[model samples]
Target: MYWTERILSEAETRNSGTESLSEGMRVIIGGATYTFSEGILRQERLCREEQEQTKEAFGFKWKKRDTYESPSVKRAHREWLLKRYFGGESSEIASLLHGRENFLDAGCGSGFSSLLLFGDHLASVRYLGVDISNAVDVAQQRFAEKGLPAEFLQADLTDLPFRGPVFDVIFSEGVLHHTNSTENAVSYLAGLLRRGGMFLFYVYNKKGPVREFVDDYVRDHIRSMSDQEAWDALMPLTRLGAALGRLQVEVNVPEALPFLGIPKGRIDIQRLFYWYVMKAYYRPDWTDEEMNHVNFDWYRPSNCWRQTPEDVTRWCAEVGLRIRKMDVEDAGITVVAEKV
Candidate 1:
């Protein structure tokens, strides 16, 4: 087994089926094991346990959230056409990162997103992908496999050992909310940029039905559930929902419930599947990754609380990060800022 995997296994033993141990966990990567000793859960052994307990918490050792991956992010402008995600206009954002030349790709998971975004943003951009796990190894391997010039480091975002503001641009996607101190994280990132540097981030919004319910489940109990526990927990919901949907009564009359022809009789299997799968892999409009991401988002132990647009604006202002643009997806929020 891989050293990191071994570390996780050992952590599991140490925790003895608990959510996490006070000592935390240690992972072995690149022939040396990097130790993370923050809070109790972040200890060498306990962090590993906490991470295992939380499914969506998978990322490099330092990161507390997953670097989302989906083919949808790479698809052409059909379904995502005119969508506000701005993934299509990545070239523009990449130019911002490229302007920095040597920048921090904060919370860079496997590096594909960075590669996809700022691969050509600059003439030569030294991208530093940071996380807390040997996930750095996976990211580095991806760089080598794809022959992309990039670097990965396993460390916390707060106590970064790097020198002064060497970055002109900072890219953090769908990360930060999972951090223990989200506000502190924002302030810290702002402190790492050059006088005129720019920072681009994607965070979740605090509104919407789908975002609300799912995030609640993750923060409360799912983050620490074992893989089996997550499966067990999600499986029953899907089964029960599917069953309820099956018991729907079919209607054949035109004016069944109203003057207009509206099909409202029993639970629709299509609707149920859509709802059920939004929480796992059996959705009407989703690939395997989307399905898994939803389920993981639900039961994973990481805290995924979203913030309002005003809240983010206030936080960025408080941290001295001036907003350039703001994009809010139902999943969360995205804001591009500059250190003025």
Candidate 2:
């Protein structure tokens, strides 16, 4: 049942320094050990103190819990919605793979990208999807339902479990920044790649004047709010963003942001946070009250952070990674890098 056996096997064959890893197979972090099984890494431990491995300040645990009361289905819904939302970024991901076989989806939430890869690329690509939450169970099930060849593991990316120099491509999107140790996570994931392997990760990116001000204000204020309260507070801003998008008069700025759930925009700065408005501020699909209720649920507590292109580039450089490409999601940074 336990996959630790595989850990020792991989480590004995290929030694690793850390007790764990960021994403590359065979993570060796301080006192942790990760092992690969059926393409996924089985993460069995983290020796950090309870206070350190906590969600006290964030309001929820990084490891999603599954119970009858809150079945994994909810996370499943979020994953489905999030994947479709991120579907636009698929081409960006394709460029990272650049004709590779085996891959590791470090923080693959619900295996959305994995599905996209198999559906579009159909390269007989082997994918290992890992997440810190029990939500991974949902991902596993979804993969099975599709009858695709993939691996799924419920493990923390901070303490990855695959052998090093094992992955040709690593896809970690919008998950690393949520980790308590951002730099460590980046370095850890970096070490997992094979000599020519590539890493694709996405983290929040700082943005426009108005948006940046409000985000800072939220981090200062709503970081402590119950999910509902955070949603309520940000609703007005989302509405204003929506109004801006649907203006009768045309403002031909090179980029602005997407409206509330309004489609189309990768480079357009204006369309950047449309989903944020739909989730944090407002939702055109839902009636005002329903939208607000959903918005409330969306803004709940979790660990979150933003990064700049320069900061992320530095991270790769520190680890001796070669930058190949960079793709910025409205609120995140995703890049492809190869180990030097």
Candidate 3:
């Protein structure tokens, strides 16, 4: 059966009391019940558990610090991320939405991305942020405290409650890869875009076999670990990344490996090591707390699928999305596509 149909059947069955639905109860946020179909409820439970693990892994203060920082700092970070992910033509994505208004931020974590990307023009555009976790509560409170006009909803990405062709722009960064089916999630989100609307997202790129093996090895060992235990276990990896970054070595590669996405050229040793050897490298500018958050994000998630450029391209085409910008980085693929 189709996943959505199966979920509806499950919802009906649960509503009929065949199974104890109360066992799946979640903490109510803002005194509102955001329940939809049974499938979404199941997804909500999973998302809530994973994000709660994230919250516990990163802690509250570190997650909220950026949102409360000075406007200049926020703007600088936004610009830095744009350039880092989108390259020199970063502005092109923003330019695509010049006259567009309604925006949806799927999988908005702590509202940091929303603030960094659109906080400057919150008054002019209508923004709605949605997540299947209690993080939505945190986002809503942060935006409300700042007096920004934004809406927050606790909804699953696979089955978003919103209607089709309603949003002019949909931004989801480092989110879809963690879903039950990244391809299906993309198709669902694509349908929500209005004609000519833009969808910008960052998803994990397929790292070479060696790196993938290490990531899986570490993640498998830490999958069932408690929050503190996972942090302690991953600390060494974070430190290794920090130490490698400090080495400041450079190397020259003689041949291009198309399969691994490596071009024949001179490259920084630290970057090469992190990208090809061990992905534990930490930014020199980040505090230890920030570094831990990075490590936890990498090792804690149960689902982390990496895709190739061709995979992303095909997915976009299948969903009637024209590829606008496709940037391949060490971390993942950042795509900006528009409805065709």
Clashing pairs in 3: 241-281
Task: Encode model 3's per-residue lDDT on 1-340: one tens digit a residue.
Answer: 1222322333322324333334444333222233433223323343445545543443332354542355554556687557744674555545655888877888886777767766556555677776766566667677878888776655666665444577888899788887777888899999989999989898988887677888888888987788668877888888877887788777889998777756789987777767776677466666555666666777777767888889989999999999877887768888888898
lDDT of 2 at 283: 30
TM-score of 1: 0.65
In order of appearance, the predictions have TM-scores of 0.65, 0.61, 0.77
Candidate 2 root-mean-square deviation in Å: 8.8
Best-performing candidate as measured by lDDT: 3
Cα lDDT tens digits, model 2, 1-340, are: 1234444444543245655433455544345655554445555563244322222322232222221113233444345434433344645455556677767777665565456443545335666777765446656766787777666665667665555666787777566776776678899888888888877677777655565555555555776565446656767755665464445333344444443323443423224444332224333333344434333322432455667888999989999889876766555676767877
Deviation in Å, model 1, residue 41 alpha carbon: 20
Better of 1 and 3 by TM-score: 3
Which residues of candidate 1, in runs, are more than 4 Å off? 1-56, 59-73, 76-87, 120-123, 208-215, 218-224, 235-290
Q: After superposition, how far is residue 278 of candidate 1 from its true place, in Å?
A: 7.4
Off by more than 4 A, model 3? 1-77, 84-94, 252-265
> Distance (Å) between predicted and true CA of 152, model 2?
1.9
Order of all candidates by lDDT, from best down to worst? 3, 2, 1
For model 1, how many clashes?
A: 30
